[model samples]
Target: MEASPQYTLTERGPLRAALKTARPQEWVKNVLVFAGVIFSGQLDDTWAIGQALITFACFCAISSAGYFINDLNDVELDRQHPKKRFRPIAAGQLPISAAWVISAVLAVGAIAV
Candidate 1:
């Protein structure tokens, strides 16, 4: 029988691991929320600009939450993949329990925003 591959914990700190898991680079996509205000020519409206910024922030949080959840779910599978094996969860840099907690906090915070 083939044995399961052993995974060793990486030396990366928890905060760095967590940030990598959150995938901030993906957050840039959330900036599209401002398109509505820009397209409507409301750039001069402080309230509209404020709302757009808030929406963008909320989307960023929610998207990061989704990423955490996805990584948690796919961790085992990711560990088997050549490229995905480097992911924080897959590589054991971020604890599954901590990922769950971070996901929950981000999701709730986004909703509260």
Candidate 2:
């Protein structure tokens, strides 16, 4: 029989936490950037659409990466705050080191773009 995919419980928490921090719901805000280009009659231009898409994606990832970094840096303080205490890092649901690693990788990806 083929082996099942391997992933530790610790690994799953970080992956899930990272996705949560990315806030997919807020990606709708990025449509505004495309709308601006389209309203300007730039929609017919493929290069414009492609570039805008890349920028939009990069910025979204960067925003999430920044959030992760902030969480790691403020974990202690967040634990003291009423609402923030429920955050992944602050709640100890996600490791601070893992958050930093994800943030660093995202930051580099954005810079290269």
Candidate 3:
């Protein structure tokens, strides 16, 4: 039989890899932070809307930080899974050290918000 093609890590730059690790698609969940404002009829209240927006941003940052931590912890296991093997960390597109730093920064920024 012919030899199968090798799967190599793509050189996704640090920024791109970090963005991938952040999983922005999952940030949609954070939009729920505005639910209270919307339900309470504060849509016309600029201050309340602003606060809700800030809360949403903080939640997004924290959630992304959590994702980075989880992916870093599960990197080895992820590499073994057919689908997860493609994750930035699991596939070696992003360095572990960078992931840690990014996670820390995100966590701190979220808290500061």
Over the stretch 1-113, how does candidate 1's per-residue lDDT look in tens digits? Answer: 99855543354677788988889999888889999999999999999999999998899889999999999999989999999999989999789999999999999999998
Clashes of 1: 0
Taking the tens digit of each residue's C-alpha lDDT, what string does model 3 give over 70-97?
Answer: 9999999999999999998999988999
Which one is best on TM-score? 3
Residue 24, candidate 1: C-alpha displacement in angstroms: 1.3
Look at candidate 1 and tell me the lDDT of residue 73: 92
Candidate 1 least-lDDT 10 residues: 4-13
Ranking by lDDT: 3, 1, 2
Give the per-residue lDDT of model 2 (tens digit) for 1-113: 99875655467566666776656677777676687678889978999999899989887878778888888888889999999998888888677777788888888898789
Which pairs clash (backbone N, Cα, C closer than 3 Å) in model 1?
A: none
Per-model C-alpha RMSD: 7.8, 4.2, 7.2
Structural similarity to truth (TM-score) of each candidate: 0.85, 0.79, 0.86
The whole-model C-alpha lDDT of candidate 3 against the native structure comes to 0.91
Q: What lDDT does the true structure give each of the candidates?
A: 0.91, 0.79, 0.91
The backbone clash count of each candidate, in order, is 0, 0, 0
Residue 110 CA error for candidate 1 (Å)? 0.9
For model 2, the run of ten residues with the poorest summed lDDT: 5-14
* lDDT (Cα) of model 1: 0.91
